[model samples]
Target: MSTLLPISAKTPAGRPRGDGAETAQGLTPAQMARRMAGLEGLVWLDSSRPGEGALSMLTALPCEVLAGRMDTDWQRVEEELEAGQKAGLAGGLFGWAGFDGRFVLGVFPHALVYDHDRRCWFDSGGLAARIPAVAAAAAGSVPRLDFSPQVRREDFLSQVRRAQELIAAGDIYQVNLAHSWQAAWPRGADALSAYQRLRRVSPAPHAAFLDLAGVTVLSASPELFLKMSGREIMTRPIKGTRPRFPGDPARDAASLSALLASEKERAELLMITDLERNDLGRVCEYGSVRVDGLWEVESFAQVFHLVSTVGGLLRPEVSHAAAFRACFPGGSITGAPKKRAMEIIQELEAAPRGLYTGAVGYFGFDGESRWSIAIRTAVREGERVTFHAGSGIVADSVPELEWEETLHKAAGLLAAWSLPR
Candidate 1:
């Protein structure tokens, strides 16, 4: 594992020093992100929703790129982050960690951080100076995408049945099964424009647009995987889901009620919640881990999810990497007995998940970090675009209904590309 040499002097905790002329100039984060499109190493951590204490961040021109495809590589990244923090380096590391240990992270010297609550942009690097020129440039059109499922309906159903069989044999209590879609990246469409369209239809609190060396990630994930502020850490896992009825209030309310009342839904969420608690216990101080919230319903533009919050204070000797290793690839996305569930997922799914169900976020040099579970996310590479949606298959899971649920979860991504469900 390579280490980051100390860069600039440290600023205050949680607050990076800006150029003192911070202003939005009446532009939204989305607009600013559009201006920054096509820039390599661009990372925009967007909070599409308002007033959640979440800040949108944009930064480019990485001083060092930290990328890896194995667990050892991830450990190196964690070590680099911890070393940077101890050395009092200014700035942060931003990028995504793919399912398993594959990741592409970068260390930036400055950034443009937007405070949603205050409705303004703070320029840490002098990079904010170019925003005016880019904003004045013409925004390009988004091309239409024709996406087709990589997994046939019959195959998906069979996979679900296999998962159920495993549960029957006590191999696992639950497993998350997924299918993917692929589309040719059209001539004129760009990652940022597609992300803009996606946010328009399905804005989320943990959304992001990350343009790396060879890959671009457009995510509108609603699940928080991990958050670290000093010694305190938290994880919010989403397990159960119900699609929303956009035009019919009565139908939507009924759907929400049914999700809340379903025994299967409740059981699914409880299993993951317990799994998260156990995961946290590994890195947190003894007796400090606890469930902050359980079996709560959170409504998004396209679906209603049963979410739970588990948190604890980290052990004094625990490093950020240690904390993440204890809880990577969140339990909500995998299932109970995570290792076995992932093994079954690999055996049954059509292809590797790549960035889907992975995590996207940042690790500040100040020891603060935040990451979101990469569901409802798309990855664009060269002329190809790929995304996946999944459902938790419990013992009583019906293959047909589970397939339907995957479609419901995929509705937002498809709608973003102007494709019919």
Candidate 2:
């Protein structure tokens, strides 16, 4: 929507081959595997030609689905659908698209859609049996890394102070702060292997490295941006953050617990809850907006987080894109008074935030979905890889500690590149 780069795994044809390796060409993975095989992993589907959805290219296959009709309000369409199931969503999207439209959708079941208990995935490429085929192509190829680093730390802080001054004058309650990172790489080694390497050295339950258009968003985040079901919209914005135990268990616990009890953290969390509720209220049924849950803690390999879940029923008039537009680039990742915080972030954080602080997930027709904020992550392009991480800054925020928090946040990706997590 911002005239940004494409967000799909499929490589475009006629686009000059960097390597002679034949880029796989056909209908998307799901369309090709219409029968006998099950689709899996973070299935991503988008158009080579922008804006329009794929029609005849898909729907040639049979499946269950849910979707957000471009013309229909999202709340009305996805009344009770799971956020990730793509079959139903594919059907819904194509069904709404009718006979001729260029809209191409992606269907992803799960990494373990075929076998959830086992950590292994069913690579349609026969990654198990024919690993050599795809593996052989691995050479000097690379992946592009992207981010929005904090521009001038002091200048950014000055903007935060300005916001605080405005707050003192009574403009708003809070604002979110952030930084970004980005890089690009050529494909060589296996992406899965890289991920496995990370798991081996630094185990994490919620880390992910999703690729779209050769741009991989590698992350080790414990934060869930939002999940939707039927009329219920649930978003858990992680507010306060603290790194994993750095030798001193007592200090780590104290740090986490202090965040739990800190007035600044509590206020920060509340502002997001309010922002989320308002965002949901846009598409939700008039009376459906409500905070079903409150402040709670979710633990991860590197940090502990303060989170809260809020839910609401969608009104019949909202469309899926409408819902996204109502809440794009997550408020928690941004700041309160969302727009203003974003403006300040652009000025403070040096680089442009490609997809670092952005949300990633599957948009389906079945009405079900789950998206996570890309934090604790790294980006890789060619031989170069980098990680981006940052913390919120309020009048009470300590710059030194905030800087430490960013390093802590970046630990996972940095670790991927043989650096710190």
Question: Which candidate leads in lDDT?
Answer: 1
- For each candidate, what is the lDDT? 0.83, 0.50
Clashes of each: 0, 73
The local distance difference test score of model 2 is 0.50
Per-residue lDDT over 61-147 for candidate 1, one digit per residue giving the tens place of the 0 to 100 score: 788898887566777777778777888665678999889678888988667777778776665544564444444346667657899
Assess candidate 2 and give its TM-score to the true structure.
0.66
lDDT score of residue 137 within candidate 1? 43
TM-score of each: 0.92, 0.66
Stretch of 10 with least lDDT, candidate 2:
1-10
* CA-RMSD of model 1: 4.3
**What value does the lDDT take at residue 329 in candidate 1?**
87
State residue 21's C-alpha deviation in candidate 1, in Å: 5.7
* Model 1 score (lDDT): 0.83
Candidate that would win on TM-score: 1
